[model samples]
Target: MAEFTVNPLRFDPYKNFKFRLKWDGRYVAGISKVSALKRTTQVVKFREGGDPTISRKSPGLNDYDALVLERGVTHDLAFEAWAAKVWQIGVAPGSEISLADFRKDVILDFFNEAGQLAISYKIYRAWVSEYQVLPDLDANANAVAIQHIKLENEGWERDTSVNEPTEPSFNSTSA
Candidate 1:
């Protein structure tokens, strides 16, 4: 039987990511994307006969279809699939990637440009939960806080903590 291998993957903002293989020198012929929500089974099917293709199509979801078909140019996959596309592009140095870094980079590189303010945080949390990357919120929270702090240093701050109080409006008390 030919060797079949798959490993953790990611995509960077500059369109670089990697898919690791189990074998010592198994080169990737190509890669594909599928949505986790559509798959009923956890098993991933590898194309037989020394081919490197992932076969699993996500079901038709309204939001997913809208994103894919936007502007009459199909994005080719849902957001998760887009994440996989990032992962596919990362298949170059053959090293394991930090999911946290992936989240942050994807945010700074792609999401931020799209005018999505919370996409980074939302997607980061989802990836962390799904991949079991960080066991506790403390770790991820620290990382996110660092990101925010850096942004603040760079003059980009958004008040989200709700710790800051708003000035009370003063109207005529006895009017």
Candidate 2:
């Protein structure tokens, strides 16, 4: 135990809004939300002298669920184009759709209050799995239409080498 110094407490929970979403190192659009990964495990049992009461916890596979992103639809056709290529919709009959056309690495960045890079999760080999357009048109409600897109990735790795880097901004509407 050293002398009592000022304890730099960095314990405040980060706000959910200060996050940015990027696809292939470029900010495709303003994203509203990104889902988290769900981890699961399997148990193995062994036969004992009396009964099979002893069990061992084995390292199970990491389940990367569909990451959902909510953003406002823009005039750009990138999303539509990606969707078309992903599902092989309206493509040339003889043309071959390779993995490069659909899969892209995504980066989800979380920032601190001082507008600095706090954490980043690099999602590997991601592709747009699903897209939905649920627009609720109303005259009284002045709300921006939010489009949702679901992406499935192979895995994600956290990057921690950044410090006080420029914070990327997403759409204003945050949950």
Candidate 3:
């Protein structure tokens, strides 16, 4: 097991709203939501002939869940460009997909209340599996047009190098 440094000053957990996503060495604009990072391991069961009543279970393959990123529809082509790399329409046969650059590593950075970087996660070999250009349009409803992308990643790990930040202190003296 890995060791982690605890923050004594912090009693409350970090908020979910303070996070940013980055890919291709640059931050994507206006990413308002990101799904949780989850992984599951397959269990292998085996039992001896003598002990047929009891089954021994062991860990097998690891499966990483796909991450969904959501944001309001805008002119930013970052999401569209990456999604197109997986599959593009109206291109010459065999050249429609960008095989070399389709997969990308992304970083998810979490910030503290003071806008300081507190923690980060690195997602490996992620590629866009699903892309929604726009959500259901409703004239009567007042809501932002949201677009989303589902990224299939091989795996993800927390970046331990990003240590807990020290909370700032504000001291005032009467003049």
User: Which candidate comes out best when scored by TM-score?
Assistant: 3
- Tell me which of candidates 2 and 3 scores higher on TM-score: 3
Cα misplacement distance, residue 78 of candidate 2 (Å): 3.5
Over 1-175, each residue of candidate 1 has an lDDT whose tens digit, in order, gives 3332322232224222222111112321222221211212234444555655655544442221100111111222232332342244446675444444333211111122223222111111122122111223564353321100011011112223322122234577774
Error of 3 at 4 (Å): 4.2
Which wins on lDDT, candidate 1 or candidate 3?
A: 3
- The models' CA-based lDDT, in order, is 0.24, 0.71, 0.95
Provide C-alpha RMSD values for all models, in order: 23.2, 7.8, 1.5
Off by over 4 Å in 3: 1-4, 172-175
Q: How high a TM-score does candidate 2 get?
A: 0.75
Please report, as a residue range, the 10-residue window in candidate 1 with the lowest summed lDDT.
146-155
Q: Which residue pairs clash within candidate 2?
A: none
Model 3, poorest ten-residue lDDT window?
1-10
lDDT by residue (1-175, candidate 3, tens digit) is: 6667778989998888899999988899999999999999999999999996999999999999999999999999999999999999999999888999999999999999889899999999999999999999999999999999999999999998888998888999999
Query: Pick by lDDT: which candidate is best?
Result: 3
lDDT of 2 by residue, 93-164 (tens): 755355566888888888888767777888888788787765677889988887778888888877755443
Q: Could you tell which candidate, 1 or 3, scores higher by TM-score?
A: 3
